[model samples]
Target chain A: MMSLRLQLGIIFIMLVVAGSIVHFLRRKSIDFRYALAWLFVDVVIIILAIFPRAMVWLSQILGVASPVNMVLFVGLCLSLVVIFSLSMSVSRLADKVRKLSQEIAIIRKDVFDGDNRVREEMNNIKD
Target chain B: MKKLVIIPAFNEEGNLEKTILDIKENAPAFDYVIINDCSTDGTLAMCRRHGFSYLNLPVNLGIGGAVQTGYRYAYYHGYDIAVQFDGDGQHSASYLPEMAERLEETGSDMVIGSRFITKEGFQSSSLRRLGIRYFTFLIRLLTGKKITDPTSGMRMINRKLMEKFTEEYPKDYPEPESVVTVLSEKHRVTEMPVIMNEREEGSSSISLGNGVYYMVKVSFAMVIARMKR
Candidate 1:
């Protein structure tokens, strides 16, 4: 069982994290998906803090001798998931940037050169 | 045929003038578009002064993205052939006509201008030659085809392959990976012997510091590309 002091500390820390995430969500400074993920993590931690017996049960099911070990295990798994998602976001962003830059360059060349032949080329792309 | 040479230049201002001049002198019939990949040098200015056709990317997309941009231009402009001509002055424009002719005559999807076929011109540093040999062997093991010079920047592709390139191109050291891609898809790829001049100025993109990383990335990409349908 978690002592009251420890549980209070956990709840206070999670509250701060949740507050920051919500603030960013309202300001639109952070992506909605990422904000939601952070909030979910906060809620999970809060639940474990509030019900230490739940953590004990989870630890038992996971074959972890101590609830502290279970907490570390969960934290490690979540971090890996977050890192993988970040990699995916970066990859997608790079692809979009490359495509947009390529299109902008071609459009600029057509307009800058001022050749109807280039315009004809633009129309040819549509075909 | 509407052939367009795609010269992707990144800080190659010193070498670009001669490359374009060579193209004009040797392959004047083919149209060209210089893909200025956000060069911080005088490459764009030189292109403007010379009145050369060019596409200036607002952001630097590296060699792969720059060349792919040219392929997109070739695609949108209805070009019959698109040739990847390096702007570093290492590749000669004299080979363009013969490469395109081989592409047409042999009915191949792509034709690569390889120096190893005749062992003529500047054979790269021995270390780099070893790397190219490894890739050549790996590609053979995977695709059952011999690609003497897998790293050659001088290559010509028919409209079919050009269309494929516009849709998607490998962003990482694309040459060997793309060759595996085409070969896996069962495209007819041929090699034409050509003399290549050593890079006139600047340096090759793969240098000593990142040589190992380059080898690992390219090898992984080739194997993955080959495994894909």
Candidate 2:
């Protein structure tokens, strides 16, 4: 079982991290989908803090030296997941930007040419 | 069949006019569009002044994105055949009709213009040739298809492959990777002997400094491309 001071400390840090994440989400500084991952990590830590006895039992079964090490290991895994997701999002956004730029260039050419076959088709329909 | 020549240009202000003229003289049966990839030079102005059919990308998309944009344009315009012609004055337009003819005669989905086949005209530097040979060997090993000049920018694709290219293409140094994609799908590919000219203006995009990166990235991409099926 964790001491009262350690339990309070863990809860305090996690609450503060969750608060900042929510604040950033509200302020639109970060995307909700991305912020949610951080919030999830914080929530897992808070749950572990609330149940230190459970963490100690699980750590023993998993061969961890201490409950704190167990918490750190879990946090590391979650952080890796978040970071990998961020890389995926970056690649997706780059692809989207490329496609958008290509489309915009084509549209600009259609507008510049003033001989849009579509416009001709529309006129023919009216006639 | 409606045919389109895709000329992807970047800061080719000195060479574009002549390249377009070469197309007009040699491949008059086909229409052409210049993909001006946000050239900081007078390329855009040249397109405007001559009233050339062009799509000016608002940003630089390197060679692959620029060529993919041309494929999209070809797809939307309903071109039955799409020819990729360089705007650097290195690729002669005279081979375009022959390429298209071979594509029809052999019923291949893609046709590559290979300088090594003829051993004629400006064969790139010895270092570049060695690099090409390595790629040729790698691709043949992976897909069992020989691509004599895997780095040639001049090629023609039928409507089916043109549509495929519109959906996805490599972002940089895409030639060898794209060939792998097509060949891995068990589609037919052909190569025609063609003479190429030395570039009259502007520097080649692939410099010696990043040659290693180019090889590693392209080789990885080709492996992934073959396995993507």
Most TM-score-accurate candidate: 1
Highest lDDT: give the candidate number.
2
TM-score between predicted and true chain B, model 1: 0.98
Off by over 4 Å in 2: A1-7, A52-70, A115-127
What is the DockQ score, from 0 to 1, of model 2?
Answer: 0.83
**Whose DockQ is greatest here?**
1
Q: Write the per-residue lDDT of candidate 1 for residues B1-229, one digit (tens) a residue.
A: 8999999999989998888889999998889999998898898998999888899999989999999999999999999999999988888888898888899899999999998989988999999999999999999999999999999898899889988998889886899999999999999999999998888799888899999999999999998898888
lDDT by residue (tens digit), candidate 2, B1-229: 9999999999999999999999999999999999998899999998989989899888889999999999999998889999899999999998898999999999999999999997999999999999999999999999998999999999999999988999999999999999999999999999999999999999988898998899899999999999999
The DockQ figures for the candidates are 0.84, 0.83
Give the runs in model 1 whose Cα sits over 4 Å from its true position.
Answer: A60-65, A115-127
Per-residue lDDT of B209 in model 1: 97
Per-residue lDDT of candidate 1, residues A1-99 (tens digit): 567998899899989989998898899999999887777777877888888888899999888898866666776677677778889999999999999
Looking at candidate 1 chain B, the ten consecutive residues that score lowest on lDDT are: B92-101
DockQ of 1: 0.84
lDDT of 1 at B192: 94
